[model samples]
Target: MEVRELLAQTHKLPNVPDIVRELIQQLNNPNADYGDIADKVIKDQTLSLKILRLVNSAHFGLSRKVSSINEAVVMLGMTQLKTMVIASGIAGSVKEVDGLDLKKFWSDSFRVAALAKWYAEKSTGVDPDTAFTVGLIHNIGRLLLHITKPKLAEAIQTLVDQSDCSRSDAEMERLNFTTPEAGQALLALWQFPENLGDTVRYHRQPLSAEAPSPLCATLHIACYINAAIGKQQPLEEVIAMFPSAEAELAGLPANIAAVSEEAMQIESGLDGLI
Candidate 1:
């Protein structure tokens, strides 16, 4: 399929659920009231309940702990709220891609989000919470793409593993659409901030000079390292992806991305706690 055909076809894609739309809009607005946001969250029985559970979960560092939606909002702040919103939407939103492995995907996404958050804390341009969420959702387009075009998804996977090709480029060659492109489209329809959608669309192509979101560039590097560490992509391919990202992240700290075996063990312990 030509890239133009894929773009034209995806126009008919479905929008995210109403709850995500509302959540994204609220989060994008810096002036949105927390009380009002809390009210909207509480109205959704499932979301409200999940927020409460997540607050009490070991993953969160609550000063005094929480047992209700209101408490979660006050304790976690907007970024955490946004994370839960994405998580809630994620739980029920996606359909499985027959050839894909959900467990691996979640593991990689979670680890990447964590790693991204750690990196964000050391950086100046990005927000820790937002970076974490970005890492988690960076490849979200791949999920929808997998469902919409499983054969192509499978072929992309095979090419990624067998050949020394970057996942996005291989996908583009096969499906005529990168995961970022699909993700950007989906996020826009869901009413997410255009910056987030744009980041998702261009993370792999950060050198496009036309790229505007520094946050997206941050996310792209985090994901590049994330996939490399988890044995999800070839190291050589990861090296190939880093030059533009290196340029994007000039100055600041020179942090090496590859996590050690001990790091994996640390992540495993943390995962059990989360």
Candidate 2:
């Protein structure tokens, strides 16, 4: 199927939680208040509960258990709350996709988010929460494909396994576009931030982005670090493979080993949410 048709099918799948849309509006409004945002979140009981659970999870390492959305807002701040809402919203919509293990997919996504946020915090010119959200949602196109066109997704996977090529290469060969392209289209449909759309679109090749985006570069290196960890590559080799130029653009350290360790730690703490 054409990428356009695939994206149209994705739009027909299901709408994200209403609260997510509302929260996005709040994020865009400079006059929005923290209490107002928290109120919007609590209106969706399921999403609010999920957010509260994750906020109180060991992943956050909060000093006290968050007992309410208001408390969560106070503790996590609006930026982190927005990230949780987006994650919960996406999770609510796409629980399972054919031919994909949601568990492993989300696990990998969480690792990338952790690594990206870690790198973003150490860098300048990018918000860590935005980087985290971009990392978490980057591969949504793969899930979209599995749900809307499982045969195509399966074919891409087979080629990936047979040729031992990267997923981006397999996707480009089979579908005429990579997962990041599809992800960008989907994000645009969802009314997410343009910066986020660009981050997902160019994560595989950050320097190829039309404009310099520090978050995109951060995700690029974070993905590399995730791949290294998956292969159990030696730390020295992982460091050697670090995209130094991209890291420089993102203003992030190329310390692959340190970022890998942090990603593992964060991934472990986020077990229940995924």
Candidate 3:
């Protein structure tokens, strides 16, 4: 089925919370204040608990426990609090999918998010927080597919494994559209910024556009590095195989050894969240 058809069945897609939608709007609004954002988050008991849990978790390594949303905002800053809220909202939206390991899926996503943030920090004009948020949500299309068409999604995975092909290729062959396309569609439907949708759409082919997006290139390299790390490849070997073209596209320095080391260190922190 086409992505539109998949999304047309609104009941099949996970329901994004109103609070998440509001917070997503805040992501693009510079005028959004910490007090206002914290007030909004505090209203949602479930989401508030999750955010607090993450803040107090080993992820932040706070010296003292944060017991309130106001305190969390003060401790994490508006950017970080917003990222965590949006992430918690999105993850909480979907409870489960048949034949999918939700824990591992989120864990891998966090790795990509952390890596994307690392790359963004090394690049100019790209917001590291935005990069991290986009990375966390980039593969959401796969979850949408699993939710709407479990059998087809499973078939695509099977094809990917048997042929040792990329998931995007397998998705195109099976569904006539790629996961990035689906993810872009979902983000658009969610009323996220147009640039975010574009980044997700072109991440698989970061240079295909007339003016290549550094954010997209950053995500591309992050995914590449995460995949390499997943294979038990040594950090030195992974860095050795790093695509210089992508690094150039992202406007990051040639020597990223320090960035890679710092990014990889956050894996343990992310593990507690999952």
Candidate 4:
């Protein structure tokens, strides 16, 4: 099926909570009342519980436990709270698939988010939170496919495992579209900012983007870093595979020897996120 057709199927697919959409709109309002945002989240007990659980988890490193949605908002700030809400929403959407290791999927995604945020922070003008948000959700298309097209998703995974090919190539061969494209379509359908949608869309081929984005290039670097670290690749190999080209485009340093260590650190950050 085409990207649009896949997107159309999302009406029946589960991902973000309805409260997240409201939270996004509220966050965009200049006159947004913090109380209203807190109240909105509290109304969704499932999401509220998830947020509290995440904040209290060691990953957040709070001195005191967060007991309520309002407390979480106050402690995390609106922007940070929004990020967690989306994170929790995505977590709730993940359903058990026959062959998918859901824990590993989210662990890797969190690794990318933490690494992307690290690179974005080092870059001149990129928002670290924006980078984190995109990194966390960039592979959402895979989740989407697992929900709607389990057999096809299974086949694509098998192709990647057996053929020593990239996931993008396997997806294109099986489904005629890459996860990035599906991710872009899903982001647009969710009414996320156009920039975020574009960032997800061209992350696999940042140079091919209509306008080269620091965020996109950062994502590319982050993905490479995550993969390299997870696979325990050598330092020289990591540099050759990641950072060199993508970091230049992102205005980051070419040396990526230390980034593997940074990526390793995010495994802890993934603690409550999954």
Candidate 5:
């Protein structure tokens, strides 16, 4: 089925919480009343608890425990607080997917998020928090597919396993669309920022965009590094094989060895997030 068809089966897809929708809107609003937003988030005890647990966990490395949403905003800054709230809301919305390894999926996503944040910090004029948030949700389409079309999703996975083709190729062959495309569609349906949808849409082919986006390029690099590190490739090998073209598109420095190490270190400390 196409992306529109996939999305039409609304019952099969996880719903974005109202608070998360509001937070997404706030992303582009510099005058957003964060205090009011924090209050609204706090009212959702479950989500707020998850945010607090994560912030106080070893992931954030905050010196003191954050006892409330307001405290978390003050300690982590508005951008980080919004990121946590959005992540917590989205993750909490999906209870399970029958054929998916939820733990591994979230772990890898978080790693990419951390790495994207690192790269965005190094790139000129990129919002590190936006990069992190996008990285975390970049693969959400895979989860949606597993939930809505388990058999087809399994078929695609089997095809990838039995062939030399990449997952995106397998997805296109079977579903006529890639996970990034589905993810972009979902983000649009959720009324997230257009730029976020654009980034997710072109992350797999950043250079293909009319105007290459630094955030998209950053995510591409982050995903590449995450896969390399997952394979236990040495730091030297990863550096040598870095996506230099993408880096140039992102306006990052040529020597990314130190950046990679720092990002991986940060990801290593975020086990609690997954």
Candidate 6:
């Protein structure tokens, strides 16, 4: 099936609650009113409670309860919000597919997102929030593949079972393209921001990205790091792929350092989130 067909099948894919999606979009808009944005967030009772809890969570470095969405936003900022959104989306959408290994998939995804946030902070002026969102959404093509063609998903697994190749390599060799491209295409169609779509498209090959992006180099390196430790790739080789990846990872600045620390504090704070 095609991309549109895949999305159509996602009626079973889980809704993110219109208010949640709206809050993210408004957060992105320069002229968006904060009061209206908070109002939208408060529309979803569960999400609002979750946001408040997250604000009070150690991840935000806050000592008091965040009574409102606006204060939560101020305390946690957009990066953590994206994490909550994605984590919640995942919890709401997951299915029990026979023979599919979802745990390994998300462990690697979250780990890479963590590393990518660090790299983005080190590499550019890109908000660590944007970096985290890009990293979390980068693998969406896999999600699409399962939704579009279940047989292809099983087939891809078989290929991986028999080969040592990366998923991007497997997809490109077999399909004449990669998941990142297809994913970026779909998110663009869904009206996600251009830079976000670009990040998903070029995450694996930052050097040859289609659009100019500050997040590309970092995402590439972050993914490499996860592939290095989380999967089969050797650490030395993955670090070697990018000139100073090892050094950058070793030298993460204060805020990024704090983020990493928070990641360790809760193995499952925003459980059920993307």
Candidate with better lDDT, 3 vs 4:
3
Q: How many backbone clashes does every candidate have?
A: 0, 0, 0, 0, 0, 8
- The lDDT of model 4 is 0.77
Residue 45 CA displacement from its true place in model 4, Å: 1.6
Across residues 72-190, which tens digit of lDDT does each residue of candidate 3 receive? 87787877787787777777788888988988888888888888988888897688878887888889888888888889999998998899788888998899999889989999998
C-alpha root-mean-square deviation, each candidate: 4.6, 2.6, 1.9, 2.7, 1.9, 5.1
Please give, for residues 94-205, the per-residue lDDT of candidate 6 as tens digits.
6544455676666666666676666656654656666666676678777667666678777777887799987777776666667787788767756777777887887766
Tens-place lDDT digits, model 1, residues 162-273: 9999887797788776778888776765567777787778777665738456676676666656656766555556545554544346222543433322223324112321
* Candidate 3 local Cα displacement, residue 46, angstroms: 0.5
- For candidate 3, report its TM-score: 0.92
What would the TM-score be for candidate 4 when compared with the true structure? 0.86
Mind giving the per-residue lDDT tens digits that candidate 5 earns over 235-267? Answer: 777777778899988888877655666655556
* lDDT leader: 5
Report the lDDT of model 1 for residue 37. Answer: 61
* Cα lDDT listed for each candidate: 0.64, 0.77, 0.81, 0.77, 0.83, 0.61
Looking at model 4, residue 144 earns an lDDT score of 77
Worst 10 residues of 4 by lDDT: 262-271
The all-Cα superposition gives candidate 3 an RMSD in Å to the true structure of 1.9
